[model samples]
Target: MSRTPYTSATSQSAKMRKDESFLGRLGGTLGRKKKSKEVSELHEEGKKAINAPMLPPGTDIHPEDTLLEENAERIMLDPTSRENPKFKDMLKVLIDWINSELEEDRIIVKDLEEDCYDGQVLQKLFEKLSGRKLNVAEVTQSEIGQKQKLQTVLEAVNELLRPHGWSIEWSVDSIHSKNLVAIVYLLVALAMHFQAPTRLPEHVSVQVVLVKKREGILQTALVTKELTSTTEMMMGRLERDAFDTLLDHAPDKLNVVKTSLITFVNKHLNKLNLEVTELESQFADGVYLILLMGLLEDYFVPLYSFFLTPESFEQKVHNVAFAFELMQDAGLKKPKARPEGSL
Candidate 1:
């Protein structure tokens, strides 16, 4: 057979192309694997971090606390605004107070029996939220009188919060993850609610929820705090409480909401000259909730921030949407809208 003679330049070019194709495919596979590994590593890190021992409530561990403030400062420092200095000063004081109080919590629970204070469920939840697991044995009930201890700690917490225009409330559940979860929710809630109103600038309302899961679980604590403009707080409370009360008493709050919806529809009914379709009626109350939520965040919060500085409006709005989406995504069922004219 005649040897296929290729020009030297042509042969080299073909070889180079083959090598390049092989390397490219290999690099592509490697790149994909690297990305997959990175994602897996992040998931693992998140799980580990959530399970990490909770730093004492008032204080933080490592450089995280300082870093948070430093980052906050950088983001918030506006030379033209007088409120920036005030906000930074407030943040420093608040962080210090939290650290001190958390230290005290550790001391109070130090002598309690580990078994009695064992709150695995509460611990898990706390770990998820704060990236720290509290030492329940170090903060158990037998070590301190329940009511008195709670009162004292709450007083200190209130003191820490008062200057910042925040408030704390405590509740106990005898059944589930008792005090452990309650405290966790309280801290989380407080952090969320601690802010100046954007819309109702003069008024600031911070509300935190403290739940111990089911009733009678004294060993577990759960707390949740949400901060909003006073106007939003009032409106939210009116909205939330209506639902809560309705749930507490069967078929009651629904009547009220129905009445409200009907009244609303009646006023607009003739104007729109529209009959309520089944689909329209089903979404009526939900649409109202969406509107109310939007109004509270917009007209109320922005006005509140007008007095303090408009820094928190974007964050607060983003947080509300995030919270709503989170609940929705987590399988929390949305309330069904009652048919219009049902009232």
Candidate 2:
């Protein structure tokens, strides 16, 4: 019968606090789980988008063709690719080659995209390359006339190059639209097919933005892509030829050149408490090479410009490419070695 008087208000207040604490903990756990799941899903989506085949649906392509098509699309879409130093170099070389070849006709190409969009330059270049004049018009000021001429030139060029296993990556519409990527591809292919004396840059890679529509929503992804195999094959041939000549004519000079280069690199890198014993292997990852260039040129390379700790092959290549860009900016000639070659 001795039940102490209970304070009803205090009991209710305590109970409410307990319930609130439990609900808070439960909410936090649920929130964390949901966040984790969302992160995992985003990561997977990114991987899929990056690795997804860029070909059209229902299209079956050979393994070799897949790379070519993907590279072509990436270049076509990448807005920054035109500013790439390698692309600029290739464009200049192609223009010079075209001018030299068409000098007899007094045709000089100042701008590849602008001058060629009218189809006049392309027609003359095609005739010069193929050694046969096309039946297309000589001059056209109208849009329809330009497109018509472009179609004729592209068709004939494709017919002539396709049989030799050269696939044209450009179209009449793309060319008439003055698509720089397509124009560069077309010019590079013609240069290779005709055995022009121009030396194109090799292993050129570009960052591309790909846009896709999913569930009526548009999403974009950025990826890096190497251009077609045509340029790579051409550069490979040149490298092999140069290497053979060095081996045959200056076998002893190879060691001398290596020693000199190593000395130079070490002299510059010594300031950073680094020494390069093997240039080939040490510079393969591009870390030391970037540092060496920065040191030798007396310029500070912003840490943000390159990966300080590159964990992937692609990152290493990116570092080397950045170094090459730095060289170009410094008014130095870029070495013949491809960015991937450093690896």
Q: Which candidate is the best by lDDT?
A: 2
**lDDT of residue 332 for candidate 1:** 64
Per-residue CA lDDT of model 1 for 1-343, tens digit only, reads 5445667678989999999999999999999999999999998677436534332232212232123321121111112221344333433433443443344344223211221133322233233334444333424454244443344444444554456544443342211213322343354344333321112221322222221212211111122223224443533422244555677787756766767766665444434354333433333233333333434344322333222221343443434333344335446643221111111
Error of 2 at 233 (Å): 2.1
Supply the global lDDT for candidate 1: 0.37
Output the number of the TM-score-best candidate. Answer: 2
Compose the digit string of candidate 2's lDDT tens values, residues 1-343: 5334456677888999999999999999999999999999998687557546553333232333223332243223465665789877777878988998799999989999898888898899888777798887778889999999988888888988787766567898778767676787788778766656445677766665554445433334566655545555665443244656888999988888889889988888899898988877888877887887788788888899898889987788788877777777779964556676556
Model 2 per-residue lDDT at 67: 38
For model 1, state the Cα shift of residue 293 in Å. Answer: 12
Candidate 2: residue 246 lDDT (0-100): 83
Give candidate 2 misplaced runs (Cα > 4 Å).
1-77, 211-219, 223-225, 228-232, 235-343
Worst 10 residues of 1 by lDDT: 70-79
RMSD vs true structure, all candidates: 25.8, 22.5
